[model samples]
Structures are given as structure tokens and as C-alpha cells.
Target: MNITVKLFATFRAGRFDIESRTYAEGTTVGDVVRELNLSEKELGIMLVNSRHVKLDHRLEEGDTLSLFPLLGGG
Candidate 1:
């Protein structure tokens, strides 16, 4: 399956802001994160096709997954 991944804020440093990736039929969100060498603790919010989802959420063909890092500021 093919999915679109969008990285926001600090997550885009040294990496693409958006990319299209191919994965197996049963690939989960966490699988994609690991493929990108990102730890779950580094993630803040996750959205699949505009809906919030958990790391264990399964991805579907043509889905758009947006990942955001934990933001901090006063």
C-alpha cells in the first residue's frame, strides 16, 4: 500500500516535510515511525487521513498520515 506522510515542526529537520511511502498490506503507524528511525516518545500528535489515530492504527492505501513532534514553549 502507498501512504503519504507529513512531518511538522522540528520533525522536518534534516528530513522531508512530506513524503510518499510504500508499505506492506498490514503496516501500522508505528511501523512507519520505526522505518523513519523515530521513537514513539518523539511523537506528539498523529493523524491518519485527518482523523486522530494511535500508533497501532493500521494504514490503508492512499491514506495521508501527519506526524507532529511534542511542542514546548512558555
Candidate 2:
């Protein structure tokens, strides 16, 4: 299945802003994050097709997944 991933905030530092990639069947959002060498503790928000979802959320073909890091400011 193909999923469009969007990285936001600090998450984009060593990654891409957006990219469409293929994954094996039964892959979860957390799987993608880990594959990218990201830390779960840094995750802020997750969205699939514009709807909020958890790390365990299953991704489908043509689905767009967005990831954002926890916001921080002084």
C-alpha cells in the first residue's frame, strides 16, 4: 500500500517534508515512525486523511498521514 507522509515542525529536520512511500500490509503508523528512526516520545499529533489517529492506527492505500512533533516555546 502507498501512504503519503507529511512531516511538520522539528520532525522535518533530517527528514522530508512529504513523500509517498510503499509499505507492507498491516503496517501501523508507529511502524512508519520507527522506520524513519523517529522517537515516539517526540510525536505530538498524527492525522490520517485529516482525521486524528493513534500510532497504532492502520494505514490504507492512498491515505495521507501527517506527523507533528510536540510544540514547545518559551
Which of the numbered candidates is closest to the native, going by highest TM-score? 2
Q: Per-candidate TM vs. native? A: 0.93, 0.94
lDDT, residue 66, model 1: 98
lDDT of 1: 0.92
What tens-digit string does per-residue lDDT give for candidate 1 at 1-65? 89999999888888899999889999999998888887678799999999999999999999999
Model 1, residue 72: what's the lDDT?
Answer: 70
lDDT of each: 0.92, 0.94
How many steric overlaps are in each model, in order? 0, 0
| Candidate 1 TM-score, true structure as reference | 0.93
Residue 40 lDDT in candidate 1: 79
Candidate 1 ranges beyond 4 A from true positions? none
